[model samples]
Structure formats: C-alpha cells, structure tokens
Target: MKDTVMGTLSQRLEENQIQLNQLLGKSTDLVTKELQLDSSTHIALVYIDGLVDTQVLHNSILYSLQEGAIQDQFKDLDPFQKLELLRKRILIAGDLSVTHDFKQFVHQLMSGNVMVLVDGTADALRIGLPGWEDRNVSEPNSQSVVRGPMEGFTENMRTNTALIRRKIKDSQLWLETFQIGKVTQTSVSIMYLTHIASPDLVQEVKSRLGKIDTDSILESGYIEEFIQDKAATPFPTIYNSDRPDTIAAGILEGKVAILVDGTPFVLLVPTFFVSFFQSSEDYYQRSDISTLLRFIRFLSFFITLFAPSFYVAVTTYHQEMIPTSLVISLAAQRESVPFPAFVEALLMELTYEILREAGVRIPKNVGQAISIVGTLVIGQAAVSAGLISSAMVIIVSITAISSFVIPESGMAVAARIIRFALIGLAGFMGLYGILFGVFLIILHLASLRSFGMPYMSPIAPYRSSDLKDSIFRFPWPLLKTRPSNNKIQDLKRQDTSKREGSAYDREK
Candidate 1:
C-alpha cells in the first residue's frame, strides 16, 4: 500500500478513501466527510482538522452543497459534470480551483485547502480555507525607534507584504514570489520598485535566490547565508530589518527586499557599508541633527571596532601614545593583575559576550536579573581578585556600549567578531598591526559587492552626488537624486527648484 501510486479517482468510492488514508498515514487530523448527492451519487470532502475554519467549511461549502437547490442541480448531471457544477455554481468558497493531478491535490489538501472528490470523477476541487493562529502585529523588539512608525512586520507572509504595500501604494512596487526549501517549502518574496530598481540587480538577486537548494529556509537568516556575496566575511553584504518603513525605504532607494515566511525580519539587498550605520529615524529628524547623529554613529563604530585593540597596542607596546600621567595611572591599576593586556581584554570581552548571549536566550523575566548579577559579580570579583584590571573593565564596558550604538545588529556582530582579531593583531605588533588590520579591512570592504553593487558605495568609488546622504545627510532640498551606485532606470528622485531669495543667484 505504501508503494502504490495514486492515479485518477476510481469509480469505487471505497478505493479512493483507502488511497487517501494510506497517503496521509491515516492521521487523526485527516478528516473525511461523506455526503449523499440525491439517491445515486456521493461525494467525499477531505481536509485536515485544525487547519480549516470550521465555520467557513460548514456555511460556505457544506451548507451550500446540502441545499435542495444544489441536489436538484446535480440530480441529472453525470459525476464529471456534477464536479464542475459544484465548483462553478454550488461552492460558496471564494477561492476554488480544479486539479486532476493527484499529487497537486494532496499538496493543496495539506496546505489547508479542502479537496472534493466525487465517486466517478477523475478531478478534485480545491477550496482555500486556511485558518491558522498567528501572533498580532506589535512593535519590533529589535529595531525600536522613537520617531518612526510603531508597526512592525508579522510572521505571516501576506501580512508582511501588505504592510509594505500600505506604505508605498504604488503599482510600480512589484512583488515576485518563490518557494524555496525543498522540505520546508518556505514562501520567499522579492519586492522592488519596478522603475527605480536596476533590472540587472533584480535579475542577479533572482538568480541567486533560484540557486538556493537547501532542505529548509526556516528564517531570513538562512536565505541570507545562501545568497550573500562574501560568505566568508563577517560584514553583512545584505541588510535585514523588521520595520516595514525600513524595507520600504530600501525599495525606494533602488534596493531589493526579500521577505521570508515565518519570520518578521526581511532582507534588503545591494546594501552599502554605510547603510548599516543608518536608522529610519535619521530621515525623521532635522538634517543637522541627523547629520550629527550620523557622525556620532560613525565615531561609535570606530570606538567599538578599535578601542580594545588600541588599548592592547598602547599598554603593551607603545606607552608614549598616551599621556605620561594617564599611562602611569593605567600601569599602576594593572600592576596587581597577572594576565597580559591581550588576555585581560579578551577575558572581559568574552565575559560580556557570554552575558549578552545569555540575556538574549534566557526567558525575559529572569534574563535581566541574571545579566545584572553576572555582570556585577564577574566585574567586581575579577577586579578584586586581580584577574583583570579596573581600566580593562572600563575599556571593555565602553567598547560594549559603543557596539550598541550601531543600528544594524548584523554589522554590530561583525564588528564584535572582528574586534577580537584586531586585538590579537595589536598584541602582536602594537599600533602598526592595528593600522595594518584596518587597511586590510578597508581593502576587503572595497572589493566586496552585493548584487553587483559595490559594498562601499559613494565613498570607495567616490560618488559626490550620493555622498550627501552618506556620512552626513544634506537637507532634503539639496538631495534630489537617487544613489548613482544602483544605476537604476529612473535616476532623478525629485525635481529641484531654486529658492526665490537664496544666497546664491539663480541661473536661467
């Protein structure tokens, strides 16, 4: 029975039921309803329990089919014609389709669609009635903002796409969907502005997505790993955000967004290195304030990436870089500590990372208490026991706080991992090693590409027109063009107009 392949529905009703039961392993959720059609013919409705809405199934399908009008309509028709009549006129389900392929019918049935089979018909009617519990849309836990829209994406794919649609209600905002993951069959959607997005980049993204042959794509992270350009690099070539406004902004900027089912986070492609430092709030604030915040973020990024490494380099190798008084103070503090500068920094950084991970993985109620206790006990005990220096603790704490200033978590994670490498290099050769490491990182970033767009756009290649929105965003009036790196079809984002009484004279 397991080896038997299902074919066209047999004239015998019992055989069809047996085959369906065998295919579904006779699961308890496999519900079958037998309804008599007049005195001669019968129909079997098969659907999974807890998947379909019972009210919809009863009112739209069962009630309509059990009516005397439907029985009269099907009384004289043959089984094949009766199936067509039921699908076309009798079934009240909004989404109705007919399929003769046994495999397709089974798949549809599993996907929360009711399959209708008549005794002598070779075809089956698939009625869409998917009803599954899902979480309500709420504020994003990861990317909260003070000035942006509070609504975040939900796990439902349709709802997520609809959220984007609500923001940019343009027909040009196109969505192309694909089903990846052979086993999970996760629905993946690629969204872009058809006129603004580059066709070549879009095609490249599509090609990459089509090439994914994984067994499961449980989250956007899985797709990110499969499609990213520099898989070995710690820096994320692709950006992901749970905020719909963020994804919409990416689309309007000629980037493509991939929305994976079952996850709120959506991936944005053709992302530049500078983009990770930006937040949606940047656009909401005054340009001057935004520019200031942007500069602060860049400064924080440098501090996070190089603070520990620079400490190791200066304390262990080049004591002259710091003031003589501060150097004396740091040395006096570390006099009782037995570990080297590298070991001390590494131990404190690893301890912070462990606490951070535990806070994230543990339950919400107990996580804060654990993290507070762990940090207090570890920091205080380490300093008192001379396992690490007080200065090292302060440096590590500052570095950790600076890491939180970066807007994107993936880029922050890359910085965190790279911080250890930089620290190791600094320990080896002091300031020269740190400079060498920074040079290599810059070179690697310049060489990287995301969907054919340079990772370090508007800076490495030096597009002055696009730089207005890079490190420091110019006023909206001065910013009238889209990013040149994208090479989109429609370049001019908005028309520029000269102010009547501006400082500079208006040219004809």
Candidate 2:
C-alpha cells in the first residue's frame, strides 16, 4: 500500500479505481461515473458529491464528452493525445491541472475538484469546480464598528483572501498557501507585504507553520494554539479578527496574517499588547476622537483588572482609604450580610461570570435578554437575601461593563481571568497582594515575545517613532512611518513632503 501510494498512476482505469476505493473506502458521497468516450476508450469522473458544482459537471464534462463528434475523433489518437484534446478543446473549466500521482489527485478530488481518469493514460486531469454553500459576508458579530466596512470574512478562505486583496491591490501584497492537517488537509494561507515585511519574520512564520505536525486543523484557533509563542500564558500572543480591514492594516504594518480554511477568523502575528486596545475604526475617525477612545480603552483595561480587587482590598483591610460617610454607608449595606467582604465580592463576581457565559452560549435572540434579566433578578434577590452587599454588586457590574469596552475579545478574556486572581490576592494580603500580582503580570508580559517581537513593544523598549500610533494614534499625515517593532524592511510609510497642506507645503 505504501509503495502504491508513492508510485505513479497506471494506464488501466479499473486498477486506478480500485486504488482510489482502497484509499477512500466506501464513502457514500464519493461519486464515480464512467464514460465510454468511444467503443474502445473509457474514462471515469470522480468527485465528492455536494462539493463539486453538479451543474458545471453536467454542462462542461458530461455534455461535452458525450455530445458531439468529439468522441468519434478520439478513436484515431493514442491515450495521451486523447487526454490533451479533452483538456485543450473540450473542457470549459477555468482552472485545471494534470497529475500522475494518485495521492495528489485524491487530495484535489477531496478539495472539490473533479478528477478525470482515462483508460490508456498514466496521468489524470483535475478540474477546478468547487461549489459549496457558505454564509454570505455579513457584519462581524465579534468586531462590529459604527464606521467601517460591514463585510466580514466568510468561512471560505478564498473569499477572505479576496476581501483583503480588494483593500491592498499592490503587487507587493503577496500570499502563500500550504496544507497543514494530515487527515483534514486544511488549506492555510499566510499573507504579508513583500517589500515592507522583514524576510526573517516571514521565514520564521513559515517555519513555525511548516513545523506544525497535526492530524487535523479544524479552525484558526487550532493553529493559534499550536503556533503561539507561549501556551501557558493567559494573554493571547497572536491576534485574531474576522474583519478584513483590520487584517489589511496589520499586513501593511509588516505583520503576517494566517488564514485557516473553514474559519472566519484570521490570525495576525507579532501582535503587541497595545494592538488589542486599538480598533480598525480608529483609522476611520478623526485623530483626536480616536486618541480619546484609545485612552478610554486603556483606562477600561485597568479598571476591569483592578476595580473589584481595589474595592475588596479597601473594604476588607483599609477602611481608612474611603471617606467617613461612604465607609458608614458600606458598613450599613454589609451589616445584614453574613459573608466577609472577600466572600461577598467573590459570589457576586462568580454570578456575573456565569450570566455572561450563559449569554454567549444561549440562543442569540434571547441571549442578551437572558443575561441582562438574569443578572438584575439574581443580584436584587441576592441583595434582599443578605448573601451579598450592594457595594460588591456595583463593583462586579462595573468590572463586567469595563471588560466589554476592550475591542479584542481575547484580551478581554485574559483580563477577566486575571481579575479573579487579583481579587483572591486582595482578599488574602490586601492591597499589597494586588500590587504584587500586577507587578508579576507586567514582568510576564515584558518577557513574552510574539514571533521574535516583544509582546509589550514600543512602550517597554521605548521606540519613539512607533509611539505615535501606540497608545495615542497621531494624525494621518504625522504617522509617516510604519511600526518599528516588527523590524520591517521599509521604515517610511508615506512621503509627507507630497502633502497638499503642511509645513512641507508651506516651505514649498
């Protein structure tokens, strides 16, 4: 069986069918139709049902092969000549390739291409006729924006690549594709700007992908887990988004994008800690508004991370930090509660987390309603029952709302998980523990790298040029250089001297 797999195809069509059958087993969806071109010549059309376009197979291969004097002309020519005639004259396929190895042909067949096998020929023709139903490009539920392109990536890899290509039309915008999964044979593509992206970075990305030895790649998340720099860390080293504009912007900044087949999410490599806070909409809006929104996202990040812990630390150990009136109010609120400040905050946070998860897992039509109503009812009931304090509920609610302010869900999730640990620390060792946890988090982030680039870049390492777009996005004309963190080949993004209105224009 191993020798046969490595060997080239045979001139006998029946034996080829046996080899394919042995390899593919008795799959009910695998369609094999034999065509008698003439009295002497026979050919087989093999493809997976529901994958290939049946209409095209009927009109192009079936009708064209059986219709005219085309069959009569095949009698005089040899098998090789006959196959050439079918390819050059008969088939109306836009893309087709000829292959001798059975393994290659089978891969193409499973990929929705129709395989043509001739009786006296050693090679087969694989015709491109992929046609399967997929969701139309719709607004990305994950990364929706008030202003920007509404068309998100579909599950179809080609459609996703085309969407990015539509934005960046330069020849330097190149894409390379390879199959990763052994059993699934999923097609994964890496896209980058040829002239702007560093050669070393592109090679490193390809090397990591090529090193992935897995049997199945079901989605982009599978690849993300496999190729990420640090698996143990809660923070996502690689960024993923369904928005093409976001992906295009990343590629423009010399980052590589990994697009997996059958998934809408595309992974961007060398993603900095600050990248998660930034959104594609930031570029669409004015610089000042974008800067203000970015500051809010950063502020929300800190609030989500430290709000509950801060409240816990102060209420549990350092009551002097709060005003006399506020402290008296908090004491009154907690007078009926049996649990300590730590337990009360923990219960409320856990309840909110459960409700938030339920909102995600449940049906979309009622998920939001369920989460909102469930939280309110549960919180009010818990307060009435004296199980949790009102102050704890307010803190949990503020933390939950702040988590949503983050643009990237991956980062938001990381912050949410870390918030629990910080809350636990605050419960045990007061403000000191929360401070220690934060210090350790910063150290961990500083040590982490995303494909050789620092996870916390431009800020920790202090690249003045790249800082223009890190925490605060500078004006469009002022952002004249690409991000220096990627070690990009091309440093200058735009020639500011060509601007219609600027200091450069005034000098001109």
Candidate 3:
C-alpha cells in the first residue's frame, strides 16, 4: 500500500482502521479494542500490546468510555464533538495529542501511545501512557566519584532529561528534540543553556544532526561518531558522561549536550584535551585536592603512553643513561630471555591486553579475580621459562595501572593505541623514535578541533583565564569566570568581589 492511502484519514473509522493495519503490516502485538459510546458513536482504541500501560487503559480510559454518565453527553454530540469532549473532559491519561494523519497515528502507536479513532471523525487522540520496561536510575559504572551526586542517567531519554533538569533548574536551560534514524526513528535531544551557549554553536549542532541520514540510531555513541569533528583520529573530539551532574555542569559551561534514547551516556560537545583528565568530583572536592588529582592524572597519561616504549628505547639504545648498578641488574634479568627488548615488551603487552579483554567479556562475579590471577601467573611463568624478562613485566604492569588512572576511557584507549605505535617506533629507532612519536602526537593534538574549538584549548591556544579550571583548578572564590575558550556570552561564573571569609585572604 502506498503512503498516500494512509497519509490522510477518511471520515469513516473503518477506512482509517484498514489503512493503519496496512501500514502496521498487521503485526502480532497490534491491539484494537472497539467500544460503543451510546446509540450513534463508536470508537477504536489502537496500541501496541507490550508498549502501553494496560492498567491505565483498563481502569481509567475503558471505565470512563463505558460509564453511564458520559454516555448521555455523547448521545447528541457529533463524532468530532465527541472526541473533543473526551479530550477536554473525559480522557484520564496524563498526556494527550490530536493528529489527523494516519502516519502519525502509526508512529505514536509504535512509540507506546494509545490512539483513539472516532467512527465519523478525522482527528485521533494520541494518549501518552508509554509503559516499556526500563532500568532504574543507578550509579554510573564507568565514571564513579568519591564525592559528588551518586545518581546517573537511565536508558530512557525523558528520564535522562529530567535528571539534568533537576540539577540545573534554570529557565535559560533549553532542549531541542529531533527524531533521527529513518527506520528506528530514535528520539535524540540536544540541551544547552540559552544565555550561556553560543547561538552559532547551537545552530551548528542542529545542522550536523539534521544532515545525518542513517537508518538507525541505537545509542548516543552512534550520534557521537557521526557528528564528531574528525572521524579518523583516535582521540575523541566529543566527550560523553553517564552522570547527569557532569552533563548539567557542561551545559552551564556553555557546552551543548546530546541525549539519545536507549542510552545512558550523554554526549557533550567542544571537548578539550584536558577535559579527559578532569572529573565532576574535582568540583565537589577542595581546590587543592582537585589540583593534586589533576596533576596525578596528567602524570598517569604520560606514563601509560610512554612507559613500555621508554623502557624498550632506553634498554635498547640508552643503557648508559641508567644508573650503573640498575643497568647491570636489568641486563642480568634480560640475559635469560630469548627475544629482544621490543619483542619481549610487545608479547607481554599483547598478553595483558588479551587478559583485560577477557575479564570484561567474562562473568562479572569472577572477572576481576580471573584477570589479576591470570596476569600474575602468566608473568611469573613467562619469566621462569625465559620467555620474557622481569623488568618488562614490571613496565607493562605499571603501564596498565597508569592507564586506569585516566578518567575518560576514550582518552585512555587513545593513549593505549598510541603506546603500541610508540613501542613499534622504539623497536626500530630507539629513543629518537620515541621523541619523534611524541612530537607527532603533540602536533596532532594541536591541530585537532572539537566542533570548531581547539582540542588543546587552554594549553595550545594559551588562554590564561581558562587555565584556572584546566590542569589545576583554582579556588572557587578566585575562579569567577567560566572557561573563556567556549566564547560564551555569560563569562562571569561568580561574584569575586564578595569574599565570604578571611581564610582566602592571600591577595589584596
């Protein structure tokens, strides 16, 4: 059947019913309950079986339609008037919409809404009683904080948006919704502060989302990959968080947040390189503690990216650079191993990666224990069999631990990939190769852009004002302005002139 047949509904409910059934392909879950209101009026309630609230349908809507009191009012009213009367006074559903198109009726029916078709009316009422099973709001698994809001986003987009609203609670906070995915017709929404986020940024984000022509958007990650500034780069140009407070904070800082249905992770745009190391907990804790943790994260980034490669480079080409005794000890440990430093390190790293992947794929109850035991046993056995050196094991272990210290898994994964590339470079050209790799990495970071903002914002572009919250967060009283890199309209974050106490009285 052509869409034209279902595009416009007839005055007769029977024709509309046939067209709706044709559009729906008469699916197994398509439910239709026929009801008679007095002598002249007839209505059909169409909805998917599992998607709608059966309790609401049976207790409120059906009971009201079948009530003797309402039957007297419907006797003299026309079909359209009857629908109007039901919509204005009788329907007990919390949310309702009227639509004239059959296509919209099918869409609403698919989205877990009940559609009511009157016998002689063209307009139908769409009841919002969606009752799909969803996971309750829970603590985030990937990004947990020692001190901050414990609640995280749920898979439902409406629930996620509510969580953000609860955090910000400002009138300027706005949300724009889009139905992407040609087939799935997934609900996607972008939220930002009207006064804080730049108008151009908002329009640009809408433009990118409009241009996407995919058939399905299953998760927020799908939108991220499609709309990111650069697709080929290992470093993520877009940042995502499962915590609502983190997203709300981003919105307050002039970043737009993308929320997709069926996903807990919400994406924040115009992310800078330093953002990967920063956490929501940083703002919750004292400035000094956040600064220390921030410094440690930066240190961990370097260690995770360079530890194994640096070890390989030094042992292969700069053994003299090490202390004399340590060099002798390292050399003695490696003497029994058959492979060269690079090969040995590569084998150990690959083994660790395998074990790490296995731990994630296995049952959660024993995953961590299995991975740890597997690593220890494999490392000791490799050394005992002279297949690898003890020094290489220590380097790999340190590198693994350091990688976990980075807050963002995406950034940590990027470092891991670059680590392997650096290891290969060291295997061929030693320390000089490592230096060359680092230079290239820095150059790439400098060139990268996240939605037209520099990836290495405060560092590469050298914004002094923004640096207050970048690598080391300055005190709340001292930090009075929002990040300048975002070019937001509202720059003042707090009133610096009103100091609360003499405890922060270091400067005039």
lDDT of 2 by residue, 2-46 (tens): 345667898999999998888777899999999887887889999
Task: Give one digit per residue, the lDDT tens place, for model 1 in 198-293.
Answer: 889899999999999988889999999989887889999999999999999889989899999999999998889999999999999899999999
TM-score of each: 0.94, 0.97, 0.97
What lDDT does the true structure give each of the candidates?
0.86, 0.90, 0.90
RMSD of each: 2.5, 1.7, 1.5
Candidate 3 lDDT over residue span 1-508, tens digit each: 2455456678898988777776768599999999887779889999999998899889999998888898888876878999999899999675988998776666778899999999998899999999989999989988989989899999999999999999998998898999998778899999999999999999999999999998999999899989998888999899999999999999999999999999999999989999999999999989999999999999999999999999999999988899999999998998889899999989988888899899999998987666656876899999999889888888888888888899999999999899999999999999999999989998999999999999998988999888889999998877878998988989999875566555665563
**Which clashing pairs does model 3 show?**
none
Instruction: Give the count of colliding residue pairs in each prediction.
Output: 0, 0, 0
Model 1 TM-score is 0.94
Candidate numbers, best lDDT first, in rank order:
2, 3, 1
Candidate 1: which pairs clash? none
Task: Give the worst 10-residue stretch by lDDT in candidate 3.
Answer: 1-10
